[model samples]
Target: MDVTQFFKAPSGPASMKRKMAAEPSDAALKRLRNDEDNDNDEFNGDEDDDRFMHGDGLTEAHRNLLDIVDSAEEAPATIDLPTLKRYVLKLEKSITRNEEMRVRYPDDPLKFIDSEADLDEDLHNLMGVSAAPELYPNLVSLGTVSSLMALLEHPNADIAIATIQVLSELTDEDVVAEASEEGEEGMKALVADLMGHQILDVLVQSFSRLDEFKDGTDDKQGVFNILSVVENLISVDPTIAEKVVSSTTLLTWLLSRIGMKQFDSNRQYASELLAILLQTSRENRLKLANLGGITSLLKAISIYRKRDPKEADEVEMMENFFDALCLALAEPEVKTTFLEEEGVELMIIVLRERKLSRMRALKVLTHSMTGEGGAACSNRFIDALGLKTLFPIFMHKGLKAYKKAYKSHSDSEEDEHVLSILASLFKTSTPENRLRLCIKFSENEFEKVERLLELHEQYQARVHAADMQFERDRIAREEAGGYDGDEEVDAADMRYLNRLDKGLFTLQLVDLVAGYLCTQASEDLVREHMAFLLNRKGKDFDLFIKVLEEYAENTGDATSETNSERALILTVVEKLQIISSS
Candidate 1:
């Protein structure tokens, strides 16, 4: 997409192109003349104009077929399959008629699919034999799943492959959803049957292009479309994962696909699908682990770890893959071995996406840390400064303070959910690691440090209690001759000791100095933080004075109280000093 061009706001008024693009779907021209296809092939149009949709152009056949499909849909699943088939046959002729549409309206089909109604259509049903079984019962029959599977090899490879790819979407989702809803083992078996027969070579062939081919855009696009079908199919029918493990050849092929560079367009989506496939491998998960699949996924994340980091497609793809991997790793089953595999720094990355990815990362981390995975995690956490690395993430909200955080809370029913998770982790987790997590998240980054301290205190009691339990267990275990190694710490049990020792001192100072960094942020972030810090009636003058002295030294160009911020600091300093001196 022309990202900038599409995102650009209306000029003094709307432009002709903008007006045409935004016209109501009912009014928009779904069909356009195709100049490219000598046979006047009409491509399906998707209304994906960026304002509403991603705005990739579709063609005539896709458009007309969709219109026919839409015109046929009832409230939900009530499509008249027999009539629909007849309509589709006619729709094919319409596409043949509009073969010339591609020339004049190369992008019209993309626009049509972007329309709300068209976009909302159940895509799986569109391609599945069940949706139109009366017309092609044999192709879509329960027994015919294998028959449909055969199309994957028909002489016209494109038609056959596309049909099978679409079939993957159709049956699997219904079967899987059915299984989940009613505990139907039969549904699972049915899904296994259809997918088990998959043409393994075709699946790999779909990904083999890898964007290296020099000619034939049509063929290349067909491959891309097939890949898209694969994405939808795997997403809906993850249970079909059994098929992945059936053949040693298929398993190795997918593993190799997962190991491929994420930057390869043809392979990128497939790599992500492979991750999903791994997660769905109910009994085969252990096999996946032994094959280094988790490491392969981490390597996928590494591919996205940019050095200079311009915000681009790679960044976006990396973000998507990052979330998928974390989500996969976080699942109860997957988390078992994932945490033990040198993933602490990777966990920190999840907890620190610097955007919404942070929450997603945290969700997965919390899941892993709360289950059996937590045992392995706690043992490994302190070795890597585990929770310490994520502490800053809990404390961040740009240069702005809890004002933004609070604003967010007001709008979202979701709390600053991380606090509770950390508290829970602190209570259930080993005391040493809990304390380190406290010291870590408690740093003062951009705005205020007090929030960090407050979160620290909220968890302190639970952490202390947990630490006590951990200490007693340690002592008893030790007396029993259970000492694991010299690496273990002596309890030096001071039950009263805060353990606000040397390492945490840096953490506390980071919390305090992080307030100053807020001023360095863009003014909006600074103003937001100021609004939060200045909300209370009380003050801390000595701390404010110290902050002012440091700000003056760091800024060199400071004119002091003439700046509103400095004046506010001086005001806070006077009040705090009085409160302190008293």
Candidate 2:
């Protein structure tokens, strides 16, 4: 039997499926019968006599089947300590034999191919150890982790790929979830050992060696599996994200891979891993910025600026890139890099073009233009004629048209992001740019203020419904032998969280933008228009003050920046109160 056939790698998204041992083939059965006949000719010749003496019982084949079943029944259901140690030893031996064979026959595939096959089978068999992650420390102590990492540099790409598959399985999140507290400690130890062996460097180096396009499906699966391994490690130990970026070229490889125009599982996986890494580690974000990650990501996503992705995976890849960009923009320096790379301009074009990327571009813009770091991005956005593109969406006319044209458009999400961008503009713009923003609301017959009021009412109604539900639930809980002190505090916390989820957060943003315009609009025309609209709804500046005060209180005192922003909101509240009294 050809052992290599059993080791064929699976294609598409990286997943772990253990390869079951194959049944014996007809040819192997014939050979086994011939050997038995030659070794025991007396028994073969006396087959009839033997059957009669055995009381018409089993033939040799039946007896063999019975023996197999008996052994299977006696086999342990799960791999235990002794079995794991033996498996590790077998894996190490396979690795050593394959290495030796390759060294002895550097130019001869026939000489080393069997060893390579054996090694592949061994690697896959090791995946069974993942089911028993509580034994990971045992597996590590057996010293096969280092051996597996070494195989990443094996001469044959298939061997390296198989090794990655094994590693991915061992470090998978499912294993993490299944592990007990002791098993978790074992997993941590195993991860530390893998890292100590420079798994990140080895994995990145394997990327250069395995050419997915040139080497066919197995090589492609290899790249995907390598990504899975790294992602799994990070999931197990979030600090690994920083370690990966700082210690290896994995981040650089991810940036390059995602930039490739060819859309494939690996590219999609690369985008996802990049987003995960960026979201997890501030140091990784800075590393990405210094490596021109912002520009690379923009260029990668710019393809969808005009044309939407044709496949669901391609669309997911686009969203991942946008998510990574937004996370990266959270870093102050990355925002600068984004502006320098014409990111603001790209987003404006995406918004105007009204492609599938429009909503994500809006979200990216909101991130780029937020906080003190966003001052430059916000100013640049206005300079790039962003207002012309944004105000149309903010007004909902363009958004309505977009939703009609595209089935997937999200009105509330788009509205939330657009309002967030406006709020950021109000917060971060300079005196000159601030006036430019306030002027937009004043123009168009106070149309922007009208829209703000419309959104305020919409979100306020949603929040009000949620608040009513909260009250009912609280009263019910109180009537049914209510919570003790801790439970009461938890219930209160849940109430606020429930409110936030049911549009309270968006409502706060709407009120914030409205309050900013009321106090700081370039002309009194915008403020009066807002006041008129508020009175029309039986609301006034006092209502705005009340919401803004609640919003400010929730801003917390965790950071000085939070305190400062809280103070700024309170100041806006004070100004609104004064105007309301007058």
User: Which is the leading candidate under lDDT?
Assistant: 2
lDDT of each: 0.44, 0.83
Least well predicted 10-residue stretch by lDDT in candidate 1: 13-22
Candidate 1 per-residue lDDT over residues 311-386, each given as its tens digit? 4444455555555555555445566667656665665654444443444445545555554456555546556655
Clashing pairs for model 2 are none
In model 1, where do residues sit more than 4 Å from their true spots? 1-148, 154-156, 159-214, 217-238, 247-255, 262-268, 278-281, 303-316, 327-340, 349-360, 397-417, 428-431, 434-582
lDDT of 1 at 489: 36
- Residue 517 of model 2 has an lDDT of 86
